[model samples]
Target: MADEKERRHQHFLVVAYGAQSHVNPARVLAHRLARLGGADDGSILATLSVAVAAYCNMFPSLDATTDGVISYVPYSDGVDDVSLPRDIADRARRRRASSESLSGIVASFADRGQPVTCIMCTMVSPPVLDVAREHNIPLAIYWIQPATLLAIAYHYFHGYNELITSHANDPEYEVCLPGLTRPLQIRNFPSFFIDVSGTERAKAFIEVFQELFEYMDLWRPKVLVNTFEELEPNVLAEMKQHLDVFTVGPMVRSPMETQIHLFTHDNIDKESYMEWLRAHPDESVVYVSFGSLVKFSKHQIDEIVGGLRQCGRPYLLVLRRDGIEDDQSHSLVENTQSQGMVVDWCDQLEVLSHSAVGCFVSHCGWNSTIESVVSGVPIIGVPLMFDQPTNIYLAEKEWEVGIKVERNSDGVLTGKELARCIELVMGEGAEAKVIRERANVLKEIVQATSDTGGSAERSLRDFVKTIQES
Candidate 1:
């Protein structure tokens, strides 16, 4: 039996979208799969596949291929540019190119005598499903969003589409989604659902998800969500009735674990930010970051700086180089030098785990949300789009560890509102204390789940066993 198992080595291929948010979780999942080994000792292997542009960004020096565990493979998405597509035509080209390129990658793998046993893909493209089917490889969707979002998307397509679409413009309108305990406001839903912009780009975005859900219904592949059972038991349970759902995450990098950055951390002294963080007292600094993709308007930047200054606490603000103009960036840096340190980017998990950092002012991206929960840092959510609004909903309402800052009628979060939320989260009041305590408790739960033999680990192991047996 051992010899038989050893002879049938299993190779897993993970394909991810080129964006930083998508790539990070996919990378973490690939590493976890590699660590699990195979049915027989030393017989398992995992490879990470991303778009060529993103691959280049991650390995800027073009120095190494394998990250010592999982091997790296790049698939052409038609465009070799790092920036995401701005129009529908480019998106279509990417999908077609990705399909052809990825199919070739699989064929080449077989030629090399290491055919993939399973393929896992994040929301990259529908072509991934076709590729897995053509190769007869078991495939799983690596859902890097909250399971709540999955449940919502499921219900939205299942039977609630009309109800949601009719009330799309009504932000305050509430609907009790199946399996969700409370009624969610239209505003709390994913931005994709409410986008009535009528632009081809927005329509294309909607069409992609629509097709994805349609595939889920048709193929019924396993969904490996990046959320723990404890964090979203209800939604997970609901999903299991129709889909093979696995709670295998909080797939966040630990403070000690090295992270792969898909974006360049340039024009900033990384050490200087860490040194400044060390200088502050415990729970005294506010850390502000909006992940890699969200480009804020100049007014929004000024509002954020105003809020941070008014909060009267030391802050470490990450303003990405591409997100702001040079002149504006320099002016904001000089203005906030007395009260905070502004950098292009820094090691987020390190900052979150630091003693001096108390609250995170975030755009509530799912990756950032899970990181905050793992690090025991509370959030002041200022969600923009995609799944961010849903993630914030989970944080503020479901988890009770954060608060959402309200934007004005013009859809702008003013400095006053930002400052108010910051104080509410970081103040010495009882509500703030409760939020802090809840965050710590949830952090412990997340850690336990990710530990050896915990629910997440067990789920991942089960997934490996299932794929190997198949």
Candidate 2:
């Protein structure tokens, strides 16, 4: 009976930071964990834990029991607000509250005969490690960004902080990191690396990462990256010498799978967007979105509008509700209706998979980058901050699947520049053809890793076996 019980079930908990980008990849990982042996195998169970605010946003009624496969559980961070606290005192309170709440949650699972076998956390949620240690459960980190970014962060905290700090102002200065084959320009590094401003947010980011890496050194948990060997072979090989790393990703969900949106959309008809796409010619429409977190300035918005209009292609733009002013919204829609459609939000994977979407104008968030790769759509990268620049570097410089828009002295990508990039990506030119073919080839490579008995599949199974034995 004990052996049967061991064979019948293993529970895995995935804790994610409460943002759309973080939560989406974490949820996808949970679903993949639940489907490990087969959907109905009953050998593995996966649960996703996020903050209460995010949970409420995804399920307005706050009635999420399970999303059919994986269970949904929310932990408290002291504040129930959508935005995280920026003040040091409030942030401390949130961490303490979350730590206590999550400890109780793990205990409750055990009380119900579902003791967690292993705990996996997304980036920036360091408290999960303490809880895992408290319960004596094995822990792993599900790195939701590219392997190159992970290498940069790991090296940044190790000993290269002072060197990079000294060259922060020199955007053109290149540095050769330990594992990467090519040197990266100072500008290509993550924004946090060069942000000399001692703002609370910036300082908080640095502190969190420092603590995460310190703990990683002490605990030595396995790091599961959301990239394949074929894409970042050298960096992956380099990272393995220092830490136990696993490549079980390109963790993108198929278009047929269900997706969770942590933000509410406007009352606009979502289906109308799909119907509109159907009306356009194949490989003719440009899709633009900058993910959920970026708040665009009005000047930037007007410039994007100008570029889309000048490009003269059928386009679909997803501008978040908070990104635009109410008075400007009406005129914004009126000015672009002839050649484009503006919606508050739509299904991103579904939109990318459509036959009409030829190119994606993106912020180069890791999720957006990987999804675009999976869908075989080339990119016009307008990277803003964080790991975005690094992602774009890989897309344009490393993968050659896209081009990054050039920003002016004032750090703004103007309408003219945006139009130029659109033309280069979508026009019938040799460069455009090369970019499109590379996108398709990378898509095939990523899809192959997720196939039956592929690299990602074998790595995931090995992880599960490690947990079961432990």
Candidate 3:
């Protein structure tokens, strides 16, 4: 039993950044750590919730009793005025205002005599890096996105001879990366990267990617991606050649063939919505959602609505109408009234896992992209910002899992184009089946890698051991 006692002494300070997307994975890892060896074993698990309190809500999933392995520490938003883009300048002020709130986290860990030995942090949160440096802890930087995208980001920052210089305007131009099987277009990069040519936004975007790449060198955190080796062998292989790479995800549980229905919702009594989905019998239903955070202007939103109306196939859309003003705004709803369900948020995992969902219209965030692929749901990539466009390119071109959408100069997505894309994804001649079958194979590999003796589980166990020693 002395051995058990020794094991229980292993502790970690799992640090997380803002948003549910970033926090969820860390929580999953924490749960895995807490359950080490067995259910009754109480391993010393503690957390320093850094950067933003947005993650505080996810603490319940990690520790139901609220006493296990958790503490919230507010951090100074290190972004200065010089770093702010026109669109995000206000956000900088907010971060600066709350910078001091993170001081308590440092105090708590110091008081406990647990000088955090290892820091696990999501990418983009500078505060975690700051604290990890201050404490001299070996940090594990979680990418929370695909390795392919990270490679692209790295390549972009390194100025790799214009990966898509002339082809930026050509949709048909196949982009050939060092490890990818096929070429992708510059448009396949996230929308922000594609459109921001010489604008202030472009410079800011460059800065963010530069920061990410610099973090890669100076910090040298063990790189963690939300993918398995089988799905992205070429990209993963290329990445490992450069860094201390580790894979611990696709992060969600693998539903077996019989259990695929485990995540599907039958109680979605939005009968009207389901009825619309049923109207397109034998035809695949395209699922369009932009996730929770991104917002579209009224014109952009209406254009999307019109496009769906024109696409003429059945669609399930989750549209958050927040901040969209118009007493007459119901006019937008009335336009595409027949073909879609525009909810604020849907059970995305459950919806993706459903048998009926054929294609996803996504922002290409890692979590959503991984979930879509794992569920064998093809996608229509419409990236907003950050790693999303990179993810979209990988999904549509490299992974052969889906297609892409085009946006106009005014940033308006036309209804006719939307309709055409939807039809191409779900129509009779569509490669929807091929996409689904390929995705299933990817899912199988991820499940195998995340199981009891799989790479992710083992790597996580090793990490836990390191935490214990620290």
Candidate 4:
């Protein structure tokens, strides 16, 4: 038993693909590993490898990796200068490149004193799976999204394929999953299941998910989801039946935000936003940000701006010029800069926590979704893609803490419709009050589950124990 345990490594290697969404949560989990245990003081020797993106967030101060607080390493996917290409084949090639680089990182770590006992790789990163197999090391999945999405994906690959694919062409097609009560529409399905361009992007995404599951089955490896079981109790229990899924997340409020931002933008006025929030009345500001990736069209921005103007509330909107629809849209954002503070980006969690932030206008990305819930802010979900539609369903349908803004006949969201949705949540209506109250209740639950000795922490400890035992 002693020898077997000795063979298991003391260090952990956490490989996160470089998308801003992926890196933030991955680093937070890496910090969790260090807290769990790794070095002589009985703490963790957590080494985190972030995929280097077009805008690399790997800072200089993280170089002294041996000091025992999680060490940072960078792996390249060939698109080290600019953002990743949209071409599917190019993405595949870069993924392979990342795998090759990570292999060398593993060797270098082993040559030093510490060998990684296990690897925890984040979503859409099958390359790390290959590296684990090559080294005969165990590879565990650190699923960054909510367990609900994971379960949806599992069902998609397992038994619901024909049901989903057959109706993939139909926008209003309903899907009946065993656990979820409300039948999901084809529009409610995750992006990988529903093709957008009528092309191979969806197929490519499906292959990636398929490979992830195949690796999980082949290794029977542990899977860690970024959710607290308290919040996703049913989904967690339902997913555990199919795979060894552990809820070790709602990975928020880590100290890593100080030195690096996964996508690294410097122009935002963080202090000014906080100050603006300070000056406003409690629960009076509508905070809008679409997140790091998804870009909105001019039509969408026009409606959003028009809605905010009509709402008669103090608001903060984030609109990047690069992603704006046109000069007209950009000018609209510029015009609204004084009406409501419009910037390229701001610390989302900071903005959410402010007493002035009454409601959040979000893209409903899982990270933003969880953040809004935990922050006790009601949502106006304007989901752009991926698990967002499903998140919107959960937010508005199941959770009752959100309202989704729907598009018009021409697939454009009108200003009047957007205002009505905002009024439903942020106005003085009794229904709006109920939604805000529910959001507060959810916020308490989310906070409780991540507390010391709580569900998320305990689950993470158990995961560490399994690594030791193996």
Query: Candidate 2: where are CA atoms >4 Å away?
Result: 265-268, 325-330
**Candidate 2 residue-wise lDDT, 354-470, digit = tens:** 999999999999999999998999999999899999999999989999999998988888999988999999999999999999999998887788887899989988888877876
TM-score: which candidate is best?
2
Taking all chains together, each candidate's TM-score versus the true structure is 0.95, 0.97, 0.78, 0.92
When sorted by TM-score, best at the front, the candidate numbers are 2, 1, 4, 3
Give the alpha-carbon lDDT of every model.
0.86, 0.88, 0.64, 0.79
Q: Tell how far residue 347 is off in model 2, in angstroms.
A: 0.6
Count of residue pairs whose backbone atoms collide, per candidate: 0, 0, 10, 7
The Cα RMSD in angstroms, rounded to one decimal, for candidate 4 relative to the true structure is 2.8
Q: What is the lDDT of residue 213 in candidate 4?
A: 81
Residues 230-328 of candidate 4 have per-residue lDDT tens digits of 666777788888888878878876422543464435634777777778998999888988887766788778888888888777789988776675746
Cα lDDT for residue 85, model 4?
52
Best by lDDT: 2
What residue runs in model 3 are displaced by over 4 Å at the alpha carbon?
1-8, 44-103, 110-115, 157-177, 182-184, 190-205, 208-212, 253-284, 310-313, 323-327, 334-339, 408-411, 465-470
Candidate 3 at residue 204, lDDT? 59
Candidate 4: which stretches are off by over 4 Å?
Answer: 1-9, 38-42, 58-68, 82-92, 196-198, 254-259, 263-268, 335-338
User: Candidate 1 — which pairs collide?
Assistant: none
Candidate 3: residue 154 Cα off by (Å): 2.6
| Candidate 1 structure quality by residue, lDDT tens digits, 177-255 | 8789889999999988888879876687778888888888887878899999889888788889989888889898767
